[model samples]
Target chain A: MTALAESRRRPWILRRRTRRIVPVAILAAVFVFPFAVMLFTAFKTPGDVFSTPPALLPREWTLDNFAEAFDQIPFWRYLANTLFVSGMSVLGTIVSCPLVAYATAKVRWRGARPLLGAVLLTMMLPPQVTLIPVFLIWNGLGAVGTYLPLIVPAFLGTPFLIFMIRQFMVSVPDELIEAARIDGASEFRTYAQIVLPIARPAIVTAAVFQFVWSWTDFLNPLIYLGDPDQYTLSIGLYSFFGENDVAWGPLMAACVMFTLPAVAIFLVGQRFFIGGVSAGALK
Target chain B: MRMTTIRRRRALTGLAFAAPFLMGFAIFIAYPIGASAFYSFTDFNLFQSPDWVGLQNYERLAQDSSFWKALANTFVLTATGVPLSIGIGIAGAHLLNLPVRGQPLFRALVYLPTIVPVVVGGYLWRWMLNSQYGFINYFLGLLGITGPGWLVQPEWTKPAIVLMTLWTVGGTMIIYLAALKDVPGELYEAAEIDGAGPFSRFLHITWPTISPVTLFQVIVNVIAWLQIFTQPYLLAQTRLNNASSGPGESMLTYAMYLFQNAFSFLKMGYASAMAWILFLLTLAVTLVILIGSRRWVHDGAR
Candidate 1:
């Protein structure tokens, strides 16, 4: 950083900041490049999209793909279903995870320690291990075509989210909970009135993750939601494969639309989402 | 005694709070795991009751060439893909951590792909890797290098999956970046003053500090690759209800195969058996990583 060191650097490449920026720029650009293609392809004419020598921009930009995507599929219906599922999922996480975190992290009870351990252990299990049996349970109740298989699990509690919230709740000063009780607040009162307010960051992180998971989820919906009318945007967008020829422009446009909500949520809650990478919570 | 009554009341309060998850675990998780184990040993296909077949499904999985291929493909990804992702991710984090303007924005751009809906990511890659008109080949063409048939050739499909996997290595990068930020800068300065080279300085300081996160990422990445479904599943689709597994079944991933046996073939018992094998495989690999990395994964207390 010294002026003398800067002036006499053997090569411009030895200029440390310039050297660093080159690779970083290339890496970032590589990651962002696909997204740029997705956006540009969405606007390109079909001919431009598959141009023999591919070009980044369309010769004549158009909105025809977005229109086609809507016409080709039940775009609005699928979007509505995705939003409802994601929103209800966020609602479910907000209501359930923190309460569970409270009991396991704040309250003094013998079961608390073992329950936390159980949560961690369960978090490590592969989803496939339980995939078939869980589906059977839903199918047995004749809830396969409904949103119950997806939405109801969030209300119960997701082990990962519960574990995350618990890690945050563990650091809550014991004095705070003790003081809330000293004020004659009941256990539920202390949770709802005091601890819940303090747990906003963790709750927001949980909401961001839950909303994205439900919105983007394919496997459960693919298996359980047999009816086209019940399909979320994910399953709906995937229907492009069923057709003989993939409409590249429309597919790209639908991909863009499908990606936006998750990106928006991530942007809005960027801090909490990134901050939830606590070393303890992950392992 | 009043003390015992108060204790009982406190226990009840905690129980009320934890009830939802506990009941959820019992019915949804514990029950399914138990049921799956029982079903793994039987020949139940949901049309009728399970008939005990002892070790038949497990034995059949041994003879199942599809099972071996799926296992091999998954291992290739995990063995090659996970390490490459971790290596590139860590290296990328080091570069991103260099003193530069716009560091935060660069960091976020790297993570952007990780959050893109996986299905969207899959379909976009399918387009992007198209041999003729795909951007990848187009770029390669510009470089005067003929790119291989990325997703089309059976030999190339797994590499395509790995390529896609690397694009999202940013998730691993961010986690390592967080760990990197925790390393005391003074240690690096001290090492530099002692005339240590960059690699040695990194060897002594950075690796030791971030090894825990590395261990964590390794285990997590292994599990993810083992259960990779959506990418291969999406890529292999040619028509509705026509189960294809890419060129020569190259894309028949373990989870996908299990899904086919259970749902498509109506072989619930067979699928359940596959589940248990997957569980043991996961457990064994996880243990190997955990036990193997003990010397390297600093517990921080040291």
Candidate 2:
């Protein structure tokens, strides 16, 4: 009995057992294994890709696939176009969403309730519903095949972004806004000075989220941009797939190139992604 | 008197701040909705001005056998995909929320797929599901079982898309994890004291608490699924025959069909009609969900 008690009291044994570690490890492997294969394939030559056992490591490491992918798709141009559009959209969404969110969350007005309801309703509608209509309108304005159709929407506040920021805005103390008001600050001035500065975290969160969405968006670019010069990375990759005949090595290389911005952005701005995703749950 | 002036000025300022969005909505949104409805009444190819034919597009849509097939494929995908994704998300959240070491690492691993572009995800999944050289098939072969041609076979294509979607459940899991955090520990403790087992406690306590979130997720996911395009487009293009008919039209979603008509075939009028039908269907489904919210969504937590 004493020996059993002593064994139970040992430091390692005393630690709380998860009763789940093995299963969770298995689940984690399932989640991660495809990415492992993708990374491995990106290093190989096209000739080695369909080898019988599917190598986890290349016998001869080569950058040939990456070079081929680049040459085939005008990858650098697509990357530049994608960066310009997605970067601007992030900047524009961050700038505009807060203005609307401030109005809804901080101000009391006759139209506030109705306006807020409108934003929520907008979130409910799938963007696909508006695809053709929006296309025709842009086409009529001669904006089709240009970046304008893609960039223009960012200047207007998105309802989903507004919803996220407004929820964050609700937690900002009314005392701060009122105190600024008493200090000879106009409402706009208080928003600029006090509210905007404090809402930086949420703004960053919105920016990162918007960047990911815009960067990865295939349909909007697929529809709006007619010329190859204006194509973003998503469309570039699509054309890459079409040209490559599903060449696993070069395809994976191109995919890695396309996905780098988002992965880098996420890693850099992880705190915000976690925070913004959580904020959506409160309401 | 001074207060009245301040209030009036504030209202004007509000309007000024909101003006850009309003203008964009009017020009880009409202104009197109009305114009698309108008176009649906006509026969328009891009080169030619629309000729008003009045309900002809709708009649043509009814006669379009491919439209019905595409619609059926979409329904089958959403019906299976949404529930499977929700199940995976919830299970993942439950596991992540438990007190465990290396929690943040696990969270990051799960969230990684969401950051990859959909095009990349589709291609990667295609390789993983390949019949001959795919790792999945090889593993199955070791067990004396043969794996079917997943992306190539018409019967298996939609299920293949569904499988790919399951990889991104991390997005939904993040939301569920946040909601699960708000579930009170005391309720679990009480249930445990009453001799309720883990499964029983989950059904009685956890399910009730998370039901609203699940409902919200269902609506968002269903609406998103109804517009499925990227997976089908990629898979269809890569299918062996190089066919636009898309794997027995198994991969031909409603959006894909709209795309084909609008861009490929240049049947703008017909595509416009299809878009309107989709819009109305989405609006109606959303409205029904909103009306039914009180019946299922428990907002009393606030």
Candidate 3:
């Protein structure tokens, strides 16, 4: 009983008997393990990669895989294409999502409730429902092979992002908007000057998430981009794997490089990103 | 007259703000919904005009073995994956919620995998899941347990996907953590004063408090899993960019098969029919869960 009391008295970091830390450590390790494998494997020589009784860490690290991945796929070109698409999308979300969210959330109109309901319905509806027809629409417009299929959707407010930003905006006090309106500011002026500045963090959250989604998206790019030169890193890595099925080192290297920008952005916007996900659940 | 003018202007301005999404909904969502439903009833390949076939696509779907296999695969993954992910996420949140040093670091570590690109995640999972040289089997062998070929064997393929599904559960964990944090601390103190143990406190207080969140997460997971594509596609893919359906077609999830029909086989009508079927099935499952939640979920609305 004395020992139990003393154990409970100690700071948890110093106590071995603490229940939570052990499981947290184990799960954290499991989470980090695949990434460790990705990193270690990227630096390993091909011989070491396939050697019997495989080692977790490299016997000898090499830069061969990084060079090979570049040669195997036009890494920089795909990177530029992905950056362009994802960058444009981040801009797109920043412009459109907040404008719509402000109208639905702050502006009092009878259509607002119905519009919010429509937003929820669209958010819940499966993308597969519209997959083929949308593809045909793009195919008809002759936008199939270009960035239009990839980038154009971003200009349209994504339902999930719109919903999230609106949830954030709903908390903005009505008095603020009313005061602005009473002062002879038009609705657009009120939204832009009074609301948008206050909603900047939410917009930033929306923007970062949009960039990441476009960066990581595969299915749309797979269908839309016909030419090999046009491939984003998401599917470009696939062709890399196809050509170098046995070249695990290069594949792993390419994957690490492919993953870095998103990780960096996630870390930078980590606070906003976590907040955005939960806002959907709670609000 | 002046007041009415102001009201009309405000209404029109609101309409102007929402125009992009409304236009997007009509062009991207509304038109496709109508077009797909129409196409589902006819044999309309990409280049050709629709030829009415009544329920032929549905009939073919009814009789198609590949469709059944795909359906079975999807059902198995969704059934197993959704519960495990929610359980882990909630359980993980509980653990993370405990006062400990470097809590943020641990939380970030857990979440780091989620931000990894799916293409990257898929390939990395495949690499780790490799039969002989892969780290997963290597670690298993070190523990004196012979690991199965995760990607090669048909029986193991779905489990591999489930395991991969579990890997990126940090997203759900973060959401659950947020929900858990929203639970007032005084409730726990009051329960403790009543001499209720931790388990009982969680059972009576925490469980009911987070049930709505759990319900939401469960529905989201169900919807996502039923359409699981990129993971299995990358996992089961063969070289030269062919989307192999894994060993013995075990990896042919419903969405993948639909994609195959739409793009590979160019069976546009059949694919559209499959799409509607998937949509209805998702709706049914979601409805069931929502209905069932009435008994369990404690709505703590502010």
Best by DockQ: 3
**Model 3, range A163-241, lDDT digits (tens) per residue?**
9899888888999988998998877898889888888888989988998999999888888888989889998887655
Model 3 pairs in collision: none
Clashes of 3: 0
Worst 10 residues of 3 chain B by lDDT: B235-244
Q: How accurate is candidate 2 locally (lDDT)?
A: 0.81
Q: Write the per-residue lDDT of candidate 2 for residues A1-283, one digit (tens) a residue.
A: 9877886778465444455565566667888888888888888877667877676777778898899888777888989999999989988898899988887788756556666787787776666556766877778799888898888798788888888888888899999989998999987898899999988888888899899999998778877887889888887776555544566777789888788779999989997897687677557
Model 3 RMSD in Å is 2.8
What tens-digit string does per-residue lDDT give for candidate 1 at B1-302?
99899888878988899887888898788999999999999998888988999999999999999999988888887788888988998899898888788988898898889889888988899889999889998888889999888767899999888888788888888888888888999999999999999999889999998888888888899999999888888777775433568998898889889989988998999999999999998999999989999888877756
TM-score per model for chain B alone?
Answer: 0.96, 0.93, 0.96
Where does model 1 sit among the CAPRI classes? medium
Model 3 residue runs over 4 Å out of place are A1-13, A16-20, A242-244, B1-3, B193-195, B239-242, B300-302
Chain A TM-scores for all candidates read 0.93, 0.91, 0.93
TM-score of the second chain of model 3 compared to its true counterpart? 0.96
CA-lDDT, candidates in order = 0.87, 0.81, 0.89
Clashes of each: 0, 0, 0
Task: Summarize candidate 1's per-residue lDDT along A1-283 as a digit string, tens digits.
Answer: 6766756765664566587788899989999999999999999998898788899989998999999999999999999999998899889889988988988998888889998988888899898889889988998899988999889998889999998888888888889889989999888988898888888888889889898889888887888888899888877886665445688899899999999989998889887877775444344
